[model samples]
Target: MIELVLPARRKDLGGFEVGRVLPAVLKRAVGPFVFFDHMGPADLPAGIPRTVDVRPHPHIGLATVTYLLDGEIVHRDSVGSEQPIRPGEVNWMTAGRGITHSERFEKARAQGDHVDGLQAWVALPEADEEAEPGFVHVDAAQLPAFGEPGVHGRLIAGSALGLTTPVPVASPLFYLHLELADGARFALPAEHADRAVFVARGEVEVDGQRVAAGHMAVLATGRATDLVAHGAVTVMALGGEPLGPRFLEWNFVSSRRERIEQAKADWRAGRMKLPDLDHDEFIPLPGDPPPPPNPMS
Candidate 1:
């Protein structure tokens, strides 16, 4: 059964716009996913200034999952990792203690650069919150593929369709990307107690209600629920066991509020290192001494 539908809060970043769907006032998260951003399907003109690039930023107690559907991004991190992620590839960076990184678009198209993809932050388990930081890139070919020829999909993590993906995860969860032909109906995996589906580029029908693009439907798992595409659609199906209450502050997430305070102190005092390649600039912590972190549901 369907529970609630959340709309992405659109934010315009000069030539690009990001749609944020998670961590809203209504619901803090879906399973371990604490933050979710839908990056452009926007086109940037040739020779666009580099000022628009994401400056090096710091994160802790979570993993940044970057997947591109179009265009390219050069990822540089403080761990001496420099990787380029293209369409159908997954860039998973775990900032257990702390990590800094930046994403630059040097592969801008001649006429314009087409960027479209999703970035999600999964909060770490309490026991692994302070583990070592690391980064890994998984190719599209390595992800397990399933579904009929016309209705295809890929398992990005966990077990689904009797296949498990190679993407490393710290918890029990499943993430999937699906392409459904118009009028084709599909059942979501019921193994997880908490789950939701985000419509990235098309509308879908769930529980006799229509959910348009840039929106997500949180489902009450146990019984089966079928989603039918209104047209050709691509969606992300994700969720798993809950990670309990978490404290969120700026770019930091932790089970302990004092840990968040420590991260704030580290970034404010320049204790956190910036990305190796993009060390020339870094995003300053907003609000200087930010307000007390809050416990997220």
Candidate 2:
């Protein structure tokens, strides 16, 4: 049975500055499913400069998924892979034991561009945490798309509705991009009752509750939930078997405190390799003094 998990909004300051996070489930209970961040579907007037510079950071025991709705991002990692991720493509990177990587705006759009996308971190089971780092880039045409008229479903990862995304993953998870025309009603699969929906483009009605862009709707496990697009709506659905409890400090994610400490030491000692980028621009490391407290606090 599917159930709804109420979504919570969290704000964090990172190398890129302001980040708004809408977490559907608590990290402790959602095994393998750890960090999820919903980025902008922001409209940029022509010639407005946009940038996404997430500096070289270490990740362990997890895989990162980058999906873009519009615009493009250049991704570079320690493994020497570099690629520009655009709309309808998937950039899936697995940091088995540990890997460091960075994300920044593509050079062509660096001067004046726009972007719309999301980044999610999926925890790897203990068995694969230290395996080896690898990457997979799936073009937009490779993902499976289904659904009736007025509604279209794009499978970004995992299998759904007789379609599957080519991106290989370690867990039995599903990441879907769904678009619904105004007033269109769609039935979600009962198998995905535990999933969460993040509205990225327009308002949507799910289980009788209205969720607007920038907000998240968590559907608790039970019977399948129905959604109606209040307007032309775009949403992302992510779910899998829950992950075990883990610790996330700075950029390292581990199931044990000692492991995180070791990772920190390795990074500081230069034991870990930083991601390779064609350009010299790099993101600064974390641990700088916090900015002045918010006056509104």
Worst 10 residues of 2 by lDDT: 13-22
Which runs of model 2 end up more than 4 angstroms from their true locations?
A: 1-19, 22-31, 42-52, 107-111, 278-285, 288-297
lDDT of 2 by residue, 1-297 (tens): 224434435453331322344333343333255777765544434433333356567787789899988777788899998889999999999987788887766443435455678888887777777779999999988888888989988899886666677788886778889999999988777575347777878988888888878766666775677888998999887776765767777667777889988987786666777775522333334664433333322
Q: Give the top-scoring candidate (lDDT).
A: 1
Candidates' C-alpha lDDT: 0.86, 0.71
* Model 2, TM vs. native: 0.85
- Clash counts per candidate, in order, are 0, 21
Error of 2 at 87 (Å): 0.2
TM-score of 1: 0.94
Residue 139, candidate 2: Cα error in Å is: 0.3
